[model samples]
Target: MIVDSPKIKNLIMSYLEEKKGKPFELAVDAGCGTGRSTRTLAPYFQKVVGIDVSESQLSVARKCTSHENISYQISPAEELPLEDASVDLINAGLAAHWFNPEKFGQEAARVLKHGGCLALYCFSLVFEIEYKDKSEELTAAFNEALLILLEFHKKVVCEVKAMYQELFSAIPFKDKQRISGICEVFPLTVPEIMSFLQAICSYKEFLEQDKDKATAFLQDLEKRFLDILGESASDALGFHVYYFCLLASKS
Candidate 1:
């Protein structure tokens, strides 16, 4: 937890002070992949349920060491098993985008006790700065690679905006809910950045699923990154701007 990496446990701890040492009666983690954040939630609540739709993912989560208060279940974010007004807080860490927001919002409202909190943390690979003082070719290549990601995800994968509205204007927090939209630039080194990408995206799957297009895209990416970043991605470290942390409440 003390690691200065972009670990979710570390981010959860950043908000620990707000927890104010108040013990939670019940808590849950939506899409708690591999229990990275599930272990963190255990200590705060009398009981914590780490839920995921994928039993395979839950299997991985269960393999991790956990506190007696911690548990895991296979369930979708849109349909949690808990009753209304049953939980003190619920966290969605870098995994909320995979949910149906209209359903998720309703379930969250259903499970949360009066004045309970709904916390989330998500980041994009868009705001990265690398290739500084590098050769022109390498720098240009890096820029092109980054741009390709934006083009593909934003232009192609148009359904990813449920969680990153950048503001709470049309969010579904209840009328009496208290919401805080947090934006922070957390600096990350190369390995940490790669791990973040692995957790949030699936470049390998994309490449495997459509080898021809993926190969072309990657070839272009390699050329651009090499041209601008001075070194191939394998050689140089990548950095990303980790920026969103939204916390809301329902009363």
Candidate 2:
């Protein structure tokens, strides 16, 4: 599951710099999976720690991550292992919805230094393909296929769909802001998009329910996408994603 959030990170950095100046000492990537977001914070912070409950994910992160300042720990978001008031930034990238927000907020407040920043962000599953003649048809078909996955989606996904309102309210920081409709476009092929679909929790559950049917559903979706584009699976397609972010500062 690739969670791309460079834009959000840049925005967080700008906010931090405006509030606390440059060279942030430490950044904590809460519930970081495979450390993808952790690596993004490496350039902005002197040290970055990725905390997760999955040892398997951390093992992969340890092997794949090359940044000298990046480290992975098997820890939960609600209970961090760091010292009190030691972290400058805390980022929960697409993983905040799965956490116990009240407990996690307490931990965030406990670990964050005065004026430290907390950023929580998540992207939507609905993607837009902007082909002049076929855009609407393509989006309709894709969304129709996506409905099956949504039906099987977990509660956390529903929380994300609600834009993490409860989670945002649970944040201990008094100074907070929420931004929505942050769109990002990426060039991807039909196969690449299917790979992303396969990574979703709902898709995984669907697969477990009936692998053959799940496989066939994705295959059909890909075929429909290719048919609409009038291109091969290898042909590049534009995918527009919308994300929402919540920023809070400890005072």
On residues 46-146, what C-alpha lDDT tens digit does candidate 1 reach at each position?
89899998888888878784588888888898899999888887888767766766778788878887667777666533354444555344434445555
Taking all chains together, each candidate's TM-score versus the true structure is: 0.69, 0.95
Model 2 weakest 10-residue run by lDDT = 230-239
The C-alpha local distance difference test score for the whole of candidate 1 amounts to: 0.60
* Number of colliding residue pairs in each model: 15, 0
Give the per-residue lDDT digits (tens) of candidate 2, residues 1-251.
Answer: 23575688789999888766766999999988888888888988899999999999899889989999999999889999999999999998878888998998899899988889899998865578656577788778878877779788768668988899899889977799999888887777778888988977789999999999999999999888888777544666667888999999888
Q: After superposition, how far is residue 169 of candidate 1 from its true place, in Å?
A: 6.1
Model 2 scores a C-alpha lDDT of: 0.85
Off by over 4 Å in 2: 1-3
* Alpha carbon lDDT at 157, candidate 1: 35
Supply the TM-score for candidate 2: 0.95
Query: How good is model 1 by TM-score?
Result: 0.69
